[model samples]
Target: MSHARRLQRELQKMHQDVPVPGITMVNTENFTQWQMDIEVLDQNPIYHGKTFRLNFKFTENYPIEAPEVMFVRAIDREIPMHPHIYSNGVICLDLLSSGNGWSPVQSVESVCMSIQSMLTGNTKNERPRGDEQFVLGAGRSPRHIRFVYDDPTV
Candidate 1:
């Protein structure tokens, strides 16, 4: 099946595993884009309890070009601290970035799990290096910010 259909099927199965209120999506006119939210459930530090809405925009070159994702809720969505995450939830994880790591063999489920793990592991309140300026500038807008992946371990 094409990757788009595959994603639709996978997302269907994922919904079965997640019954949380905020986690859902609907394909746009362009099947490459989706609107979804991730409700945090892990018991952790700093981000113990929060629901974050994220937009996932896949390119025709998906798997090759990692899906473009961004935070949706501006006020409550404070970027969680992590080595691979920018101040605006633009994740820099190798599994989701361009050349540093991601491969076509990886599935959408793995990506979701990685994001869950990343959030659960965070405990700091700071942004990646100089993300303060980035955040204040144009980090909130997805189309404007492009993440450059430098490190994998966060």
Candidate 2:
């Protein structure tokens, strides 16, 4: 099957697996990108009672090359504050990372779900532990950053 087709199938599986309320790509013309909404379900320190948009852009070399994911909106403030996420809502998940372990078998839906899982277990409203500077500098573009989670104490 083509890469697009495989991605679609993977998305379908993700929609089925995700328990949170969100939409999946069901359009015909644009299978490369997906749009959805995610919110702070659990009552945590911050990000409570807030909703954020989720955007996933699959490339022709998806799985092998991580999809371009981001959060875009007028008043969006629910960006994932992970060690790898940028300020513009672009995530720095492992699968999306370059030499870390990117493969061609991943799917758009799975990627989204992975993000959801990452957000599901959090209680902080701040960016990754100590990436305030990078977040301010990194724009929405695909920033090339090899995450160094050296702070095992975190």
Task: Name the top lDDT candidate.
Answer: 1
Give per-residue CA lDDT, model 1, range 8-126, as digits (tens): 66666776776444354544435576656565576666666775656677776666666766555555655555665665667766666565567776655566556767777666666
Question: Model 1 Cα displacement at 38 (Å)?
Answer: 2.2
Candidate 2 residue-wise lDDT, 49-128, digit = tens:
76667776766766667766677564654565654455666665666766755666665555656766666665545566
Per-residue error at 100 for model 1, in Å? 4.7
RMSD of 1: 4.1
Residue 125 displacement (Å), model 2: 1.9
How does each model score on lDDT?
0.62, 0.61
Models 1 onward score TM values of 0.69, 0.69
Instruction: Give per-residue lDDT, candidate 2, residue 120.
Output: 66
Count clashes in each candidate, considering only residues at least 3 apart in sequence or on different chains: 0, 1
Give candidate 1 regions above 4 Å deviation.
15-30, 74-78, 136-153
Error of 1 at 15 (Å): 4.5
